[model samples]
Target: MGSSKAPSWSDQWGTGGLGSDNYEYEEGDKLKKSSSSNKMSSAKAAASAGMDKAKSAALVSADKAKSAAVVGAQKVKTGTFAGLKWFKNQYQKRSSK
Candidate 1:
């Protein structure tokens, strides 16, 4: 038997190797994905769903923030314009005396 290299991190994690090197199958051999791969894909889908939820929540928060900012700015602008109008009226009344 050929002397094999010492098992590295893959052996420690029981994943065989960094990539799908062990998963590759030669032609004419019956090959099918392992249940572990299926589990991994399902986990990936769950992670994606969570990420999508986060993304939607962030978008909702941004929209709310934008709405609040626009409402606040409108209030400030309206108040400033009205105050200026009142000031002009007061000055006119005093000068016309």
Candidate 2:
């Protein structure tokens, strides 16, 4: 009968497991580099989203301010017209008396 030995960690990781110190170190370095890159990408995406939200808010505020200014101008024009009419009527009444 032939005897078989149990597979080691190096067999699973293709010579880059706990048994091989040099290969393990190299694999760890690669993993660290990849993780750092992923973190940087996530941060960049978040910053872009934040900037978009701020721009949208600014646009909404500007539109509201413009609308308010238009309404205010209309009110001022109506008030001035009403005041002038009242003044003319009073002046004519005083002149005729």
When superposed on Cα atoms, how far off is each prediction in RMSD? 7.1, 12.4
Assess the local accuracy of residue 93 in candidate 2 as a C-alpha lDDT between 0 and 100: 100
For model 2, the superposed segments whose C-alpha errors exceed 4 Å read 1-36
Best by TM-score: 1
Q: How does each model score on lDDT? A: 0.74, 0.70
Per-residue C-alpha lDDT of model 2 across residues 3-94, encoded as one tens digit per residue: 43433444546644434433223332331112346666888899999999999999999999999999999999999999999999999999
What is the Cα-based lDDT of residue 14 in candidate 1?
A: 56
Q: In candidate 2, residue 57 scores what lDDT?
A: 100
The 10-residue segment of model 1 with minimum total lDDT is: 24-33
Question: Who wins the lDDT comparison?
Answer: 1
Error of 2 at 58 (Å): 1.2
The clash count of every prediction, one per candidate, is 0, 0
Flag regions of model 1 displaced more than 4 Å. 1-36
**What's the CA error at residue 24 for candidate 2, in Å?**
20
